[model samples]
Target: MWRGLRVALVRERFTVDGVAALIGSAARAALDRGETTPARRAVRAAGAAGALVRLFLLGDVLPRDEVAAALDPVDVDEAVTAGLLDVDETGVRAALDLRPHADAGLPDAPPWWVLSDLEVAPGGRTADREHVLGTGAASLSLARATVRRPVDTLLDVGTGCGVQVLHASGHARDLTATDVSTRALQIARVTFALSGLEVECLAGPWLEPVAGRRFDQIVSNPPFVPGPPHVEHVYRDAGLGGDGASALLVGRLPAHLTEGGVAQLLASWLITSDDWTGRPRAWLGEAAEAAAPGGLDAWVVQRDVADPALHVGTWLRDAGVDPASPEGTALSERWLDWLAEAGVHAIGFGFVTLRRTAPDVAGTVVCEDLRQSHDDPLGPEIEAWLDRTAWLAARSDEALLDERLLVPDTVALERGLVSTDEGWSPVAATLVRLDGPQWRHDVDELGVALLGGCRGHLPLRDLLDLLALAHGRDADELARTAVPVVRDLVRHGMLTAVA
Candidate 1:
């Protein structure tokens, strides 16, 4: 029956692109926004595909003849027996949403049929406690951020509907998915079975199911929504206090990671002070100290920050509750009160990547706000930057100054000019990376000249001599001043040396 259904979907082109084509992008987007009118109209025009979509995706009742004709090889009666449908004299309605999903970055991979809980309507009602989540923006974001390099084993924590586990199956030899909800594990079982793969779907909170074991990689899009203390849905609410789920997962990563292993997660942390870096800095310290080999490298990129009200409202809408209503207002007040009691000024949401470094490698933490759009599938870019950072951090000032450096093609040296009553004066120069993380570094004029002169043959000593001669500065003073700035460039991957 499953094979027949797969064939029917393939023959009908029932995929993400296909749906977008049938409904047009506007209506397709409307579906995401919980407006199904335009989508219903558009899917109706899609013929047999429309019938199948209506019966299965929209949870709409379709004519018996229409469903039979749409899925000829696949038995509709078998679908009913499997509890996928409830058919009557008039038509059929799906028990769940089974839809085609494909990752834009993973074009070589086949499109997946995802089955999970239904969405809440715009009128804003919350989901059931046992709700199993399907693919959403955050799910896809973690997918794109996940480093897809092949690994020996992967541990998927809080594997709701098994989206991350499914992706990890492609590159991981041994895959294990853990969740506290039994229903989630059941959904994960079906989700894995649909993908023609196998996984160990264990039942436990976080890593309790896989105690005393280390994984080459661990990926999770856990229940990270910060809300009031009372738990409504297991899929989004951790039942832990005030963003504790995120902190717990990140802090425990060190104990679960093998040497040089990496863990990535979509998390939100509370900011209790004016300095945004304070919270993550403390988390990194705990994670590193707890990790085996006693060192971990951390990169935390904050994508957005929501104040108390906005945070509560955004999550309320996510849970399908309208914030404008009396119930939603009360819920918001409770969550806000919780935040106030905890002394949380704002909530920082972002992607966190932690790596258990080799014994000789130094522990480091970098937390910064990058509140701008970025390219997807950033894993490779991030891995390369981490390697560069580790290499630069390992170098002493003398050792760093002794080596020749080359500026990458992606980096452009720009000079900032200040216009005043006097002629335009040079204020600053920066090395701007146009791709990847979009990093920029400030540099002095001599530093810029030295970086440009780095043709793989000139060392820092040679550059200092040239700069001192050109600017009439002492060589010793120039080296002392320019080396630190050059080191920063090296750390950020603007400057590099031959391997």
Candidate 2:
């Protein structure tokens, strides 16, 4: 039955591009905004694809004959028995949310189908505790940020509906998915089957099912929501106290990673004080110190932050609870009380990437706020970050000075000007990266001269000496001051070591 449905979907061109072409971009954009009227109108004249869209995407009930005609070779009774469709006196509707998804960053990649529970309508009843989610913002972000280099083995922890595994299938040799909810595992199995992929699904919380086993790569979109220590929805709540789920993964996942293995996960943490990095730094510090042989290198980027009130309201609506209603008011009060008592002033949402290092090597953990917009995939940037940091770590000041460096074209220098009595004068100079993370750094005249001289022609020591001579300063003192500055530039990809 799954094979027949797959064939029918492919034959009908029920894919991401196919659907967009049929409905137009406006209707597609509307569907993303949770308004299906435009899509319904656009697909009214479409054939089998239209029927499938109405039945599955728009949550509209179709006549039995139309469904039968759309899903040819796959008997309606078979589909019903397989729990893919539901029939009532009115007509037939989708029992699940099956839709086409592809990596927008990889245009050449083939489209894949995903199966999960349908979304709850606004003001409708809350979702089931065990509901599995399909492609959404969090999942898509993790997918886009994931490092996609080929690996021998990969693991997806808390694999709700197995969307991460679907993205990993192209680059990983062996795939394993683990979840705490059996229902989610079941849905993920069907998702894999429909996508024509094989994955080992294990039912257990976070890394328990794969104890003593190591993978070359691991990815997770864990239940990192911060709230009271109780489970209302299995997909978002870890049943642990505030932000414990994120801490748990950060501390434990290192032990299960092979040497040089990389793990990326979406996590949320609480902000009790002005120091947002305090919690994550402590978590990574403990984890890396206790790790075997080599420590763990962790990079955490805080993408968004929400205050306690806004956070509560956002999640309340997400669970299908109306915040204005009596129940919602009471729930909100309780949730806010917990957060207040815990001294959490805000909540931070972001991704963490950890890499296991070689034996006897110390690891580095960097935590920072990067709320800027990113126009490109972060996988390559992250990979480069790890490499650059490692290179800097292995070099001493003397060793680094002997190496030549060059700035790539992606790095741009910007000067801020202010109107003055005479003319527009430069108030500040800043170096900006045009690619990943788009970091900006304020620089002085010496910094500008140093960067301009780094053209892969001379060693850094020679450049520093020339700058000191030009500025009538001591070369040794200049080199001493420039060592840390150069390291920072290299770490942020503002400067590159010439090979």
Candidate 3:
């Protein structure tokens, strides 16, 4: 039974750290690079864990007796009966990937023993339409970005192996997981059963499984891979061509969100117009329109963008196609040709977050690009920034001036000193906050000089006066100039309210 496997895994300390230790740092690092040879070698001496590392984790064949010993509390017979293992004349090999998964970014969350299709790292076949994914970077990104505040109900669309549900289960009162692939749903059910948790399972595309329903929260790391024509994988590529799947899911999200509900999704959208963020904003507007009186507020962050060529190659590689091969070259050509014809200059990858708010509250669509990598668990930072934006949107500059502000301790300032023929000239100043993304706001010298006093102790008028006195400038003019900068800084999270 799944319960028995769970117990055996716990007994064996089949944890992230445990596996890392058995494999050693080199092997671990190599594994991240998708090379399993080093890791394969490192786990050779690892007793029962070795068999598991061989049979399930690494997709290597293990002697039948070794598998029986490693999975003792949950016997090999059970694993075989449970469809987790396959025995052959040579030895026993994995039918799927089974490993301990934990996210250090979310320390409060429990670890999960995950089950899914094998990966390239384990020398498994290319992920097919029926493949169920184990936890990967995209899944981890969704987990890290999701605002972890407790909610009554949560829905996970495209719930591959139920990893998202596992992350959400502790917080949500009711959980519903949906997957288009029947095999994926089966694995997800196994995931929950092993964790001693229960979740309602549905089968269909996007939100079809949950018609005429709304939830407090929804999260999906759906099939957003913009594959070339006839891409086989269901886990990454939606049947609709040219990133249609991501658009449809995002467009319909607002209607299924309860008042104050937030949906977080990782998706890729095509770059059609001159602007990168334009289409995403339009999608948000459509979702808002669908929600009607209670419009959907959106904050979509485009994390990365790639040209058609690079995008095509990336997806080709993702599907485990050799770039040098004939098929890979042909696929790339077709996708690139399509992009060229369609005027798709680039493909933008990002997270789309839509919040359904009350009828009286006017909604907004914030679409921006952030290519830099920052720290993890940015949920609180996002919530803080969103709250700040809403507050700023409601207030005029005069009211904002009256409100004392303090920059959060996480913020740092940089005054760029350009080298010239004569001497160093302080040319630029950038205010940055630590929010897992370099949130940089440019401020002038006067704005830079006046920021030291922004400790929530002084009103805007007072800070301007102080700066004017220090700089021997007109206080009124200084106030006029600095108020807007401060407001912008506050909005961008470089400055925070004292409270």
Candidate 4:
């Protein structure tokens, strides 16, 4: 049935690009924003594809004959029996939210369809306990942030509807998806079957299903919501109090990863004080001690932070509860009170990337806030980060200085200019990266001169000696001071060692 449905979808050109062509970009954008009226209007005259669009994407009731025509090879009776559609005297409607998805980050990757339970409209009733989620912002963010190099095997923990598996298929050789909810696993099966991809599905919580087994890469957008120790929705709440789900994965996932394996996860942590990294840092430290002698290299990037009230309200709305309603007010009060008692002033949402290192090597843990807008895919940057950090870890100051270095074109030196009586003068200089994290570093005259001399032509030691001579400073002292500064630049990709 799934094969037949796949064929029919292909025959009808029910794909991401195909749908966009049928409906204008404006309608597509509106659909992404959760408004389907524009799409319904645009596809009103569209033909068989239009019928499918209306029935499936827009959640509209279409004439039975029209839906049948749209899904030609697969009979309407078969579709209904397969639980893909519902038929009644009024018309036929989609039983599931099946929509075309193409990884915009991977342009050459093939398009696929995702199958999951329908989304609840704003102010609609709350979702069921086991509701399977479709492609959402969290999943898309993890997809863009994942390091997508070719790997022997990949595992997606909490594989809700298998959207991440679809994104991983292009690079990973073997795929496995695990979910605690059997209903989600079932829906993920349908999603994979319809896309003509094979993935092993296991039902378990966190890393239990994959215990004692390791993979090259592991990715998850788990149920990381922080609240009371109760499960309201299996798709969001983990039934563990106060961001325990995120900590659980961070602690245990390293052991389930192969040597040099990488795990990318979307997680949320509680912020009790000004030290936002405190919780995550402790989690990584504990995980490192438990994993192996080599430990784990971790990078936690906090993308957003929300106060307790706003966080509670946001999640309440997500659960289809109106904050203005009496029920919403009661729930919000209880949740906020719980947070206050627990000393959770805010909630931090971010990406956690961990790499299992060799037993002989020490691991690096970096925690920082990066709330800036990133328009491009972060996979390359993340991969480069791991590589750069590894390179820095393997070298000493003397070894690093002996090597020549060059700055990539992506690194630009921006000068802050102020209008003076004579002319515009440079007051401050900052090094800005045009790509990946867009890190900016303030520099002084010596820092600027040092970087200027790094042209991949001479060793850094020689360049530092020249700078010291020009500035009338001791070469040994300058080198000692410059090593750490150069290491920071290299760690952030502003400076590259010439090879």
**Residue 212 deviation, candidate 1, in Å?**
1.1
lDDT per residue for candidate 1 within 1-499, as digits (tens), equals: 7667777888888878877788888887888887888889887667899987777667788877787778778788987886666788877877666888776656777767777866653244544788787888899888888888889999999998888877776789999999999988887777777667678889998889988999999999988887666679898888887778888888898899998788999999888899877777777777987785657888898989999889988878888878988988898888888899999989989989998988777877878777866774677766776777778778877888788888889899788899999989989987898777778887766677787788788787888798789989999988888777776677677788865
Which residue pairs collide, candidate 4?
A: none
Clashing pairs in 2: none
The estimated TM-scores of all candidates read: 0.91, 0.96, 0.90, 0.96
Model 1 stretches with alpha carbons more than 4 Å out = 1-4, 17-47, 72-74, 88-90, 121-124, 472-484
lDDT of each: 0.81, 0.90, 0.81, 0.90
Q: The CA-based lDDT of model 2 is what?
A: 0.90
RMSD of 3: 3.0
Clashes of each: 1, 0, 2, 0
Candidate 4's displacement at residue 393, Å, is 1.8
Candidate 4: where are CA atoms >4 Å away?
A: 105-108, 121-123, 417-426
Between candidates 3 and 4, the one scoring higher on TM-score is: 4
Model 3 shows how many backbone clashes?
Answer: 2
After aligning candidate 3 to the native by TM-score, how far in Å is the CA of 406 from where it should be?
1.7
**Residue 98 accuracy (lDDT) in model 1:** 80
RMSD of 2: 1.7
